[model samples]
Target: MRLAHAHSVQQSGAYVRKFGAAALLLALCSSVGVIATSGTPATAAGDATSASRARTDELTLRTGQTLAKVKASIPSGSYAGAYVDPSSGTLRVLVTQQAKAPALDTRADAPLELVKARYSLAYLEQRMGEVFAAREKLNGKNSRIVSVDVDEAANSLQVAVDGPIDAALRGRITRLAPDTPLELVQGNSFAPQRYAGSRVDDFAPWSAGVFIYNKTTGGGCSSGPGVHVGSTKYMVTAAHCATATGQQFYQGHQDVPSVTPELVGTVANRSGYPNLDAMLVNGNTANTVYRSWYNFYTASSAPWESLTGQTVCTGGAYSGERCGLVIGQTNVCSDSLRSCGLTIATGPVNTVAAGEGDSGGPVYITAPGLRYSGIVTGPVNPANSITCLNYPSGLRSCSNAIVFTRIQNILAYFGASLN
Candidate 1:
């Protein structure tokens, strides 16, 4: 997508490409205005709502820790899924049956509410596989299916589509997993939104979340956390940033007048489209990643595993630091049905969780310091957004929701660990 001027800011651009019914991941490059380079920025404080959210984040983390322990103590087959109640700010654990729940050992300070579920997470996951097997029958020439994911709260598999599904196709999907609860949702579609343009002066000992321009395409995107494959360090980015291996990426934006930017790295490997959207760049990388504008030390040894209803943040090159984004769906597929295993997060209405030029940026949590969560992939229902957040100066479609690939999946794919 080309950047157009809007709201006195240059809208960042995500190089648009189409694949079937969905937009393929785009090359990124966005020129952002001057940003803070020093001091601790506000974590969206100074208001009642922000203050409430801060408390909720702390509670969510604490409850999440408890939930982890609870799951570890129980049989996998007995558990369904878990989520933090959005309204009450309480942890809710789902079990196949109330009788399957283990003896509670809470300190009275933090209590986990167990809810009986109709199906286990494993059951829903198995059904998801079966549904994917019948993608061709469900997604046809006019492809209406946007995404398929397990809705933990609903204890069912949700199939998101842009329009109505005929009775025959519904029956076909139902037959794939008759016992599994299937939910058909309308008016939902996702598109790839890798960004183009850039940042300046991203020096050596490179950190993630800084801008890097593709020398071949002249498009740029924010970087992800650094990782190590054996003894060598490499940078992580969205695979859509470069079409092939060996392409060089430069530090800073491409539109920096007549100046040539510094070299960041070369694409060593890439996994895209139908698989996890990530790429490895052989470079001098550090364990630090950008939170807002400044770099923060990442807990490389403890990369975060995403959970439904968990809060998240992103530091896009163009969108800067945005937080209070809640995970809405996990292990989801895009509208194309090829891009699968992505996580989706939604921000406040009309707010930007991430925008073009944000792809490949770090999606992390920041309660007890920054922890890597995933890499920004794109926007959900990209065609229609409540509002667009300007990038320096331009018009671009931005949704309150974002799509990302988990960090564990990326590391596993590259046979690397967090740096």
Candidate 2:
């Protein structure tokens, strides 16, 4: 309905906020953690611990460090939290801080069981590399995963995972390697685009256009204010926008057919094909031609390592204009598109943040004019759920986060440099 701040009381609740009784039911279901249980003694024994225990186990950290040593070292201020990965059978130790400390406690009465298990140095090294690689592949870029050595002597793990590695994975790694030195690599081929500004109603000095393609009816469907990448025109819309077989591009301000509509480019390389529902549109000359009329700014080539708290803006046919702060970025892989994620924000934007016809509008950071940020791909509405096959009967699920095609990746795909 209306595009409002994510923190607003109306919007700031859990996923079930809009569902009412259904939400309460879902919460109950989650708390119970059991769907069906057989009436057998073994089943009853299994039920001794609720299914939520299993879920909690999944998130819990078990360490492999000896109990005596862990207990003896507990008061050293070096220990934090510990857990074990059931899937990998590795112990993970979360360090609270980095400081000099005595050796781990190896007393027989130490509470090692309570501390959870930890992985061997070698295992952690390999696992860190695997995480690094996974993030790189997902981000469609490269990065390094620095290994941390956990020593009983120091009571800390010196970890390093950072740089211009990949946007999708950066946040995760940062969370996993908290307080560690993460060097973000920059100046690489894949960099994130900054938000410019949006097109207000009948706004002057800002070129406004729509992204369109032919539908089955011999007519056309359109979405607009395609973002400009460089001298070449490009629009960021949903992959579904150009999914029609005979798709064509249209450039205009409103839904009305242009008096002399020019043919812009159609979607070429689309990510989040199935799940994310995003696409990249290569504009025709008509697209770039319209940009001249408005004081449109070109995309930036600079790589944005992170956007938390950074002021941003968006310009679209629907949500005329809005501004806010970058909250976070996440990597989301759906059946349609893999290795894709989006950067999210909360702010005072247009009334209707986005609508059906606003799929390809640009999301930018505006100072006075506009610095190209990203293209609006999808809405983060709670009503929209991702169709994922997690249930036995095949079901879809919903999440609070929205998805977008990273602008930096789009510009690189077209071989266009952001200003």
Candidate 3:
């Protein structure tokens, strides 16, 4: 018999009774692209202010292709970073050597801009590592460091911390990467969000975007797209949901005596922080995932890489379907202990991207087909708090920004294909 997801509701009174709100959030530790090539140094475009503007709808596809071409033309050693300017719809490339910029003829679709950067991407990444090493020597437990990643636009290393760093400690870190400047920015502590699923309940041949409870860990979160490892079918989710192999998963929330949860699968493999925070649940699974309760979307077999300024949507059990989120940064590392290559997306300040119990849900694009992009890791608290939207009582935590693991990395690490 194929196992499926149980119907989940917005009413949280019962959910809160069974599992405390804070416990669910805390237990959540468990819950959870491509294009062209161009060569030739084209004449550098004017500054960002003078670039032509194109409609976002028209520029999204062209921007992806143009960025690909630019990447292909430049040597990795010379490539600093690149992204689409949200306001201008201009493709911007940062290169250590302006002479190596791709010769892109701007289409009516989108404009292209090339900027000279002081350092190469490789150098920034190396310096980021050095900073992390230096941090370890200076900070032990209770460190204030929140995240560390390359700010491609700034051509510097962004070191996010919750509190101010003393001059002595700052000097020590700065000395480690004397050649690269450090951008010490302030941010709130990021918390991993967990939960999502539609059709509150369903049977074997389970689809993605469903509520899942890890029986071993007693934690609940959402299921990601299904995947295939050899002949075995497995469901993908956040590794924090169940840390070890052989852990059992259920399709429904933990119920009282009147109800029984369905056994969905067992942990076949898992990867955690400092790596892709994902896991494979061996089960009778399908490639289908929910966009809405009654609407099912096909999960693209090919995982697409993320790009900044791209508009994407998220599917979570609690939040259902939320769109209009823009990719803010790619190749981000959350805190000193987490893996790099993570992406951060943000919506309007007052809007909610994904709420509690939304972790491990599908982050995707629906154009052409449902293209898989990534999975929700959690929310990054903004310096200024955003209004939380209405959700289940215990799951009201929301944010304009979220951190996610890129699907390409998750699949590559597992050597599996989206089912």
Candidate 4:
């Protein structure tokens, strides 16, 4: 069956080898930017709208580029995070020393604000690692440390947990790192799970965040990219969502027994935390895999890329589309999934929070170019989650904290590219 799946990917279309659909689609979209593409829904961007989008796109790119310059211009361990403020359309860099921070300006003339932070990114990373290690020290000492994240916006390292951190744990954190600020939460902030919904016979028109069911068991997850290893194809999803390699996946929504879905792919687990989350769907390569942030029928989409402070969006079958800003990046650890494979730390982007069922969905940006940069690996539990786009009051909206595993890493792992 694996051999057959490989054959199907190689045979998805001969045209791809000669004139890949991806290349053709890029050309078509480029000639007239997708934000400006015709036949789009009425709400789609118009010519003027496209022009404005172009300007914002350029601004977002400039913000990131400028932030990079500022970041590099300063010595290491000087700043915590850089962000493009959506409201003010400004570039803000978190600095450990007010005077030592670089004084730079973006071409967009975006405002630059250097705010003092208690710790630099380098220090935070170093200490966060210690904090993670500290979790073991506090095993039964009464702290509910589910995961730890660097909250640059707040200039502190925020810890997510199933419950509160007692005085002893807080004291331990302070003693471990006197320079760092700390905050505690009492629940799984990023909960990725199957939401209740009816069945869909087939994902006729393929989309990145379409429904994917566990064929033998009874549940579903959203489909990720149609990734390939050499010619062997696979799909993407959260590791917590997939139990093992060859675990059957289908295009159905109903639970098992009530639904025996046609096999689309089996599990091909990627490098993901066994207990926490992340995974891949290996097969169904012959089928079209749409990597859109919105549309399911679009023939081509952007490749996976990454930039720290750019704006982006997320899409899941459960929650259609949610757009937000890029906060930064962090690595999360869990007491669950308790092994090397399960406990291994995952580098995840802190941005564009999505709700339940959005796990394994794509995190992307539209400016400079529309592309899928990473996969949603957060909102691991159903607690106070934010609805996609329904910000301020939705599930997993705290800090609008959606985490992602970079696509570049995923592609590199498989030694393959998108079809």
How close is each model in CA RMSD to the real structure?
A: 20.4, 17.0, 20.9, 18.3
Per-residue accuracy of model 4 over 1-419 as CA lDDT, tens digit each: 00000011233422111111111111112211121111111111221233333443344345545666677776667777865565676778888765454555444445677888777877776777787777767534444465665667777777655555677777877888786788876643222222232223434323466666565443345666666667676666665454346778776454334544567767765343432234567665422323332234321232534444556666554454566645343222222111011101112344335544555666655432235666665432223232333211222221244445555545533455665
lDDT of 2: 0.36
Give a tens-digit lDDT track for model 3, residues 152-214.
Answer: 888888776656666765676677778777887664443222224334574567877777877
Misplaced by over 4 Å in model 2 are 1-235, 244-246, 253-258, 275-282, 285-295, 298-306, 332-339, 348-351, 367-369, 384-403, 412-416
The top-ranked prediction according to TM-score is: 1
Ranking of all candidate structures by their lDDT, best first: 1, 3, 4, 2
Per-candidate clashes come to 22, 47, 25, 27
Best by lDDT: 1
* lDDT over C-alpha atoms for residue 318 of model 4: 49
Compared with the true structure, the alpha-carbon lDDT of candidate 4 equals 0.47
For model 1, residues 24-135, the per-residue Cα lDDT tens digits are 3322221111111121111112222343333422342345456666787776588888776645756788887654444544542246788888889988978876686666
What would the TM-scores of all predictions be? 0.55, 0.40, 0.54, 0.43
